[model samples]
Target: MSIFKQIKGFVFDLDGVITDTARLHTKAWHEIADQVGTPWSHELADKLRGIGREESLDIILRAGGKQDAYTDAEKTQLATAKNEHYQRLISTLTPQDILPGIPEFLHDLHEHEYLMSIASASRNAPAVLERLGLTQYFPKIVDPNCLHTGKPNPEIFIKGAAILGLEPRQCIGVEDAAAGVQAIDAAGEISVGIGDKDVLRGATIVFPTTSTLTLANISGRLKEAA
Candidate 1:
C-alpha cells in the first residue's frame, strides 16, 4: 500500500502525536493537583485530554469542588503558570522526542505530496515544532492561540483541512486524545488515533502508538477502513 495512492493530505495533532509533551503535561497536572491539594490520577488526567490548558484547569477546579468562579484573568494566570512549568520541563526535547517512526512517516507523506497541517489545542505547539525543526513540515497550523475554540468543536480540524486545500474526508487527522478523535469525527474527517487504545473510540482507525505508524502502514489501514 502506498500513501500516495490512499490519502490526499494529512492533518496532525501536536501534543501526544508529534511531540512527547503528554507526559510533561501529565507531570505538570500532578504538580498542580498536589499544590492545590486536589487528588490527580490517570483517570482524571485522561479526562482532561485534548483540551486547552485553560479548559483543563477549569475541569480540574471543578473536580476539586472549587465553586468560586475565577475571572478570565485568573484562569489565564493558572494556565500560563502551567505552561511555564511545562516549558522548563520540555526544554530538553530533541529529535528523539519525535516518536520512533514519525519523522520518516512525515517524510514519506511529503514525498508523496500529501498536503500537511497541524490542528492542536496547545498554544505552544508552533514553538515546539519550530524547536524540533518541524515548522517546515506543516504550513497550516491551526492552534488554540489562533482559534476561539479547541477540540471537540471541530473548528481547528476543519480549518486545517481548508488550509490544506482538501476536503475533510480526503484528509486524515492524526490525534491522540478522545476529544481530538471526537473533533475529527464531528468535522466529518477521517481520524487516526495515536496513543492509548481507549483514546481512539470515535476515530476511524486506531494505531497503538506512533512507533507502529508508517506511511505504508497508514495506507493499508485506510484502505481497510474504506
Candidate 2:
C-alpha cells in the first residue's frame, strides 16, 4: 500500500543518519558494561541501538544480571559517565566526518528550501550538527532531554514536525534504527530506513546505507509512493 505524504520537511536522526557516532556510542556503552560487569554480547549491543541514555544503561545492567544492583542515583551517575565518554569520543568529529552522500542530500534539500529538523534521541544532536557544520541546514531540533519518551513512542518525531510548522503527514522522517523508524511510522510520517531491510522492515522504504541515499533515489521512492 502507498504511504507517501506531502513531504514538506524532513525529520532526521543525528547519529547514524548524519554521521557515524553510533560506533562511538557503542564504545562508550561497552566501557560502561565492562566496568559494571555486564556480559557484553552482540545481542546486547543490538538492543542498545536507538536507545536513550537511561534505557541504554538499564539494558547494560540487565545484561549483567545487575538490574537491581544499582540504585537510581547510581544509575544516573553511570549514565553521566557514559555520556562523558561518548562526548570525548565524538570530540574528534568534523565536517569531514559526515557520512557518505549526506552533503549532497542536504544540499539538494536546502536548495529546495525544504524545512528540516532533527528528531534524534541523542542530547548531543546540536553539538554534533555544529561540529559537522550542518547546523545551518536544520533550524529546529527536538531536545531529547525535554522529551518524556524517546523513539518507538513517536514523541520526538511529532515534536520535530511541529517545530517545522508542518503536520506529520507533511514530512518524511529518516532513520537508521528500527526503533527510530517505528517512531516515524507511529508519528504518521513517511519513513526512510538506512540499513538492513530485515532490521528496518517497519520503514516505508529501506536503503542499504547512506552512500545509496542520494536525492534522486529519495525522489524516486517518493514518486513511487505517490
| Model 2 ranges off by over 4 Å | 1-5
Candidate 1, 60-143: lDDT as tens digits? 888887636567787777778888998888777877678778898888888988899988887777778877878888878875
Q: How many residue pairs clash in each candidate?
A: 0, 0
Tens digit of lDDT per residue, candidate 2, span 1-226? 3344356899999888999899999999999999999878888888988889999998888888999999999999999999999988888899999999999999988898789999988899888888899999987999888899877999999999999899999899999999999999999998999999999998888999898886678878877756
User: Which runs of model 1 end up more than 4 angstroms from their true locations?
Assistant: 1-6, 69-71
Residue 40 displacement in candidate 1 (angstroms) = 1.2
lDDT of 1: 0.82
TM-score of 2: 0.96
Candidate with the greatest TM-score versus the true structure? 2
TM-score of each model, in listed order = 0.91, 0.96
